[model samples]
Target: KLRERLKISGDYHECNETNSSLLLLTENNTSLDLNISRDAVFGNCLDLAVKKFQKRHGLVVDGVVGGGTQRALNMTIEEKIDKVQLNIDRIKWLPREKNERYVIVNVPEFMLHYVEDGEIKQQLAVIVGDRKHPTPIFSENISYIVLNPYWKVPEGIVRREVIPAMVKNPNYLKKQGLEAHQTWDENSPRVDTSWIYWEEYLYGQKKFPYRLMQPPGPKNALGKIKFKFPNKFSVYLHDTPTKHLFKKRVRAFSHGCVRLSQPTDFLKTISTFNPKINMKKATKRLKGKRKQFIKVKNQLRIHLVYLTVGINKEGQVEFRNDIYNYDKYQKRRIR
Candidate 1:
């Protein structure tokens, strides 16, 4: 009965009516030796039993039994039934269909996957947000991509980081390629660089009377390409000039935006599968000085997701480091 409920097919290796009956008996943590005589049901073919058990539960398929495989096999029929059922439910939580292609960002594992025709074509390590600044999960269409975009300093960033730094050294903004702008109305307090020494303002001893913005260049925080999507959060995926940062296995060093290790490779991959546009020309265009904006020929769906447990190509369930603590939230939701 457990075998039927598990949907274990007769086509599986070493499976039979007799073993099927044993499955029901041993399904609830009951132990049975493979050496049992052929006359006995659910006995013999220990190797085949282990392999089948592993295959069904998304474990490494080694005929030789191990602790993990043993633990899984020993699970009661109800427990085994629930494991499969839960994964099925999890699958439902994912996007079922897409318009031919999409980019998938699994936040928990800190990886990005490109999927086409319901199969993962390419995967790359990604730096997600830390616990304090966890990456948000959402789906959006990639409308257009910007090349060498300018970094617009947000208000919070100016007040928290820039203003204090400027007070210490008048040349701080100059070294960082920042320019000051004064545009407040008459009612607003005036800030005069001539009166308030920049050195004092950098140390928080005085306040600078201006807005600062760093221009676009190699030193600019945003390296090159930036994928644009309409969202309230004003967040977008982009390349970073600090390419060395991607070398680290756990790259969670960003203010808020998602940073890619190999953004050029990603762009090539996305453009290749896209029905319109020549990927070769696009690659060539990036070399030019002029910034380019290419609208996706066919709107591609991009899903920013999080999953601590996932299956690999070998069908083995792999666990990744939970950088964002999303697993606890998911587990709680499931419970």
Candidate 2:
């Protein structure tokens, strides 16, 4: 009956039985109450309930029943049931027992939670990978943190993007702070970009043996700091040069790495738990313009999760968009 009542949609400013019953039924059914009357009128009470519902579900907190609100409200009981069950299966796949410390990033929600002993330490907004380059769901330990990190250009990126861009514009490398090296080694001699045959590799006439790297600087893609974890995906939780991207609501705008909004604060948070991290030395390195890596004495476990539905701190069932369509991958139960 609740699902049938929620079937009504569209922009509802004034009150009718359609909108009134929908809002009242919603408040009664969910963990929300506006003290709204059952009378058929779109009053302030019902409006507050609508916004509250939006906030709980991570939707834009607009009182009007817009496209997004309508879609979420229109979700059938059966569909919501399936979503909850699918996420339950996902939770079961997680670590059976809680650990001393761990961080979990729910990809769908675009938020990271630093949890220790069942308490949340810090929460931060994150920009994850886009559709084409979706952030892989996996678990790993943060091995170390790098200060003034060099943005090492991946081989695939070198061949596909860098080479083509270089071909189009001759001064692209110099302008971008990119240095061509003889090999992938710290002490390797720098190769003159002018000397290398750019066309041969770009045209697939020959394999590019050399490597390209962006040294530690303002032009660096990894910004000033990075949380390094040795993983097969070569992905890291790092600071981004494009800080303005964080201001946006939906923040899926990266190649594959997770971009942290507050890297310095995150560093401080990490230091609080890990005694071995030298805060003074790290501060000095960050101020200086040189690359340095500090090993993590106590490696913190991290899980990149894809959950579309879960209970929030308020104990209300919160819903997130199936950003990666991972929810569809879960097999639905037959009635």
Q: How do the residues 1-335 of candidate 2 rate in per-residue lDDT, one tens digit apiece? A: 34445545533443333444455454453434355656523456666777887877778786755567667766776888888988898899987546778889888889999988888889999999999889999999998999998788988888888888988998999999999888888569998889876888885567888888888878889999999889999999998889999887688998889999999988888888788787888888888778888888888889999998988777878888887877776653333
The local lDDT score (0 to 100) that residue 65 gets in candidate 1 is: 40
| Cα-based lDDT at residue 14, candidate 2 | 31
TM-scores of all predicted structures: 0.63, 0.85
Worst 10 residues of 1 by lDDT: 28-37
TM-score of 1: 0.63
Backbone clashes in model 1, listed as residue pairs: 27-77, 34-44, 166-202, 167-201, 167-202, 167-203, 168-202, 168-203, 191-209
lDDT string for model 1 (1-335, tens) is 33344334333333334434344434433333234344443444644655555654445566534445545555565654444455456568887764678888877556788888888888887776677666777888877887766566766676668777766666666677655556432223434443545445544455545665544577667677888877876777888878777666557777667888788887777677565656677667667635677787666688887655576676654444456655445557888
The candidate that achieves the highest TM-score relative to the unseen native structure: 2
In order, what lDDT does every prediction score? 0.63, 0.80
